[model samples]
Target: MTELLDATDSQTAMLADLVDSVRAVEETIARLSAVRDGMLAIASRIAVDVARQASHPDQGDMAVRSVAAEIGAAVRASDRTIERRMDAASWLVEAFPAVWAAQGAGRISAAHAQVIADAGAHLDHALHREAYAARAVEAASVESPNRLRRIARRIAEQFQPRTVTERHRDARELRRVWVKDLDDGMAELGMLGPAVLVHGMHDRLTRMARTITLENAQATKASTEETGEPDTRTTDQLRADLLADLVLTGSPVGHDSQTGVLGKIHARVEITVPVLTLMDDDPGASGSPPAELDGRFPIDTDTARLLAGGVTGWERVLTHPITGALLAVDRYRPSDQLSRHLRARDQRCRFPGCGIAARKCDVDHTHAASHGGETCADNLAHLCRRHHMLKHHSPWHVRHRRVGDDRGEHENDDTNAGRAGDLIWTSPTGTTYIDRPPQQNAVTFTEDNPP
Candidate 1:
């Protein structure tokens, strides 16, 4: 028992050691992958430059394709070693322009140089130069490339417009002409006009001017200068209040027929609810029964006209010839019959990855109806708008099949008769699959049934 226990303990230690080794290897691999990615970006840029240079006559027989092949071969020397080296070199060249400049100046480490080279790719030359200057001054401070990118983005956003051209135009018109009470405020505002006083002034300034009179009065406070209170009302609020006062007080010209003073101007709006009904085939049900449709639903003028079928707010009722049922407003018999037949045949969208219901789909004729295909149920299939357009415009091919033998020895089965069962979809690259009709059986019995 002791011997067996010792063996088990030894096995456990070996497994633990193995796990530790795997973890260490994984961490190393991740670090190497990150380094390799950086190098690849640099290598791609180099390849592009090399290809452009190789097109010249001076570089006869030397081509980018040949250089790329050599690089590929070197990388395969030991799984991705060359790639890692190239990626590292590329990152150094791309990120640190300042480092390269400093190298020319006989200062800065290779690692520090590489960071500048990588940063250089995304930044403008002037910005890079500025960043380099800042870095030189603050050598101990570590600069993050990500923070630099955010700063760059903020600088770009500053140039963006606060409002559109039309909005600016409207605001200018409102400030210059539509707004009133300009003359009084203009004198207090110094050289600026009344338009500037009303529109351009900040919220605090407008609020203070509105509540606090420039002149001192005989009540409560001894002097207006003694009391200090922050202006609470916004500029928009003050403007609205001022406009209300102007409208309430009659205009200087006095009320006239064209002016229509606030009190004189009168307007009225009327709203009415109409009757609605659901009609059917029976002769007795020809007209709506008072009790059946008795204002149960609120019908607007438009809906009332559609249901009642008249020129103004109602129209004549039309019935289906075969069923003798009241039809929907826009529907006519032959077209509706075709629609019903199509709905019955293709009960759901036929696309391979789609299971949309027929009610939400459009009936698509497999063969074009304009090319003499009958407008019958058998010829139609349900497809949602997106898949319908995809079928019509894209390279996907759909074939409809009614009868087919099961995948076994040939014996014509009557079980599959008359059912439009299969649809074979062929992809652009010639891959095919048989999309079976949705099974109706509650219990799906297969070859091997459970005991």
Candidate 2:
């Protein structure tokens, strides 16, 4: 208790000093944890080497398992976890020397290292391993593991072009959706499928959840005005009920003919299916690997066909194949053009370190529209409600700039020409940094773009 209270230093320094200490502690933890992961990898490599010197025929395998089991038992971990670490250790020791060094230097964590290993594990040796490591390590140094995984997968895809068919076949054979229980008496569900279809489903569900929630709120408001009652059902509960209703009945709850509802939900699913894949394509010539889900997930060509047949009309988005820069979309609503462009361009809130998806964001003008800011792509970005309010109500400032060929500040002409723009943020503390629009790295598939 005394030490805990002393942490505040109420009798001495101010609250800001206490906050600095906590921040310092976080850095120390990350550094130590990364070093510990590197040490574990070294230890795993030693175990494999030691096991290789076995005296008996089966001793090599036995030694490895025994070592893993012993470590797991000592650390109160599962055999699965220990064995995975053992494999990661071998992977790090052999091919990812730089990643291992970064781990030891506290630039990345074990989770980050493991993501790097998993990203390239599908490819043959020396297949852009050095390039992947360099790019992935740089990303891991600053980005979250999820972002690093996405970057690593993009890098891996460039080298694993030949595995497209095999990967799709594997995914088809391993297709599964399951549920499991958690420690708190709650249950969780999981699904794996073409990335586009999956994200589309998620996007649909989010919209559906919002739809029912707003209606329910309106109903509650009307009822309260009439009978003096309030709605106690939480939005999470409503979303869950809505999902169950959809899965079981193909229609969400709170729906009625009298409500003049569309009797359907609108989900914006962005996909990239090669032109040939959509035609009565040549089966002998392996179809383009699954259509990309929102330029990220893979939807097997067959499923893409199925989705195409089911939907009456789906929106199309175009991007530069070489640079992965979003180009254009079929715009039906003039008012929504700027919003859709921001979503397609940013894909997430542009706030530093924020991961809120752009679809659920407010398109904010970096320079206020009331102050002569033009309603153009370069001048706009996605910011969730909280961050959007923060930008306008708080001390934060954001500026949009297009870095031209000379790398100097130029006019927005370059971005208007389909190039990326840079966002400069100045913190209330007087520190400044640059943020770039998040886009997939240039993915070159030799099968499609044969040299």
Candidate 3:
């Protein structure tokens, strides 16, 4: 018995050592990637300078392509791929030096750095871009690349000199649709247009699929599991089928109604509007922050107002004037006060690094209700189905905490101050990670003023 206990202790120590080594290797890789990006950026600048100083200035594109090809051959990559990487590296290193440095120190990953660079790429002023990089890097340090994207976009919008409406007008000209053929007798269809229009179209499709699914379930008189129906398709498959049917025949499969699903079902989207933005008549004169679309990214005030005007239902969300934390929301319907507040506070899944939208998630209790957990805002959070199940069945455990509880650990970080709620998650390995709600209305725009 003594020998077996010693062996078990040795194995546990070995496993812990292996985990630490893996983490160190990951950090090393991130640092090396940042260094490589700097090198690529330098190479691109040199290539451009050489092309400009050459005997023929008009052939600059060809000259750079030749340089790219030469480097690609030595690196075992395609010339076009090398050229693309060179351009991207130049953009990242030049536009967001702070982000690059953060990545070099392994404070943030390459993916996080790229997301920051892309978010601020549209800034026309140097000061605005610099300010954006500073806050974006801070936010990216603690967030996954997916979650950071939304935060970065909001930060970028705050610094834009031109209003979102003007940008949206110019961007509308580029709206288009295309089809790409794929292997195995399949093809992908894509569309690029206004976010409001695209998201609405998708929402309509989802509602139609749900309607059809409910009707089918009623006819069978049982759920998919009990019926053992092999013909039953997933929600995604149903949406695709419905989309193809609607596009080709202007209706869904087996539809006989004159109005049809297309006419009956409508798209729904969540729009978070600032009172100033909504009330302002002049887009250029108003300094209000841009409205948020589906709690993901910024949208023009025009779109937000239009949606607000047309919609029959409205939930008035009141946020803190400074911290942007949710204070209250007017719930007209019964038992909607908690639901609306949770949705507004937790814009996405509260699971660490999860980016699934709140609308698609289930409101889960941090502590089980069956175990004496009360049904209140303090004990509730939005979590996707996957994470919700994991919280209940897996080794992971989550607890709700206020902002100041862990503020000391993240000294000099201002991102957490904007969150209305925070969750402390402990992994099976006993490592804890803090997940805070995304910052809402956290616009830093002092850089635009006269110093």
Provide the lowest-lDDT 10-residue window in model 1.
289-298
What TM-scores do the predictions have? 0.27, 0.39, 0.46
Top candidate (lDDT): 3
* Model 3, span 1-451: residue lDDT tens: 5764656777989988999998788778889999989988888877677667865444455555545544554554655677888888888888888888998998888899889988887798888989999999999878899999999999999999888899899889999998654543245899999999999999999999999888887867755455555448778999999998877656454664765655556456688877677887974475677787667767777878888899767888876655566788785656678898889888988865556779999999888899999898888999987668657654567888754454433311345442337787665545555677777753333434421
> Residue by residue across 1-451, what tens digits does model 1's lDDT show?
5764656777989988999998566545534544554555555566557656756442422232223323443333321344445556555435543444443342443443444443333344555445653453234124334444444334333332343454445546544323222331111122333454546545544665556442223332555564655445565656655654555653545546565565564332111121223333332244332211111112233443343453223222333333323333323333465564443334457665454556678888777789877655556778877567656654566666654534322212224332354665554445554444443211222346421
User: Which is the winner by lDDT between candidate 2 and candidate 3?
Assistant: 3
Alpha carbon RMSD to native, model 3: 28.4
Best candidate, TM-score-wise? 3
Distance (Å) between predicted and true CA of 138, model 2? 3.1
- Order the numbered candidates by lDDT, best leading: 3, 2, 1
Cα RMSDs of all predictions? 21.9, 27.4, 28.4
TM-score winner, 1 or 2? 2
Better of 1 and 2 by lDDT: 2
Count of backbone clashes, every candidate in sequence: 16, 1, 0
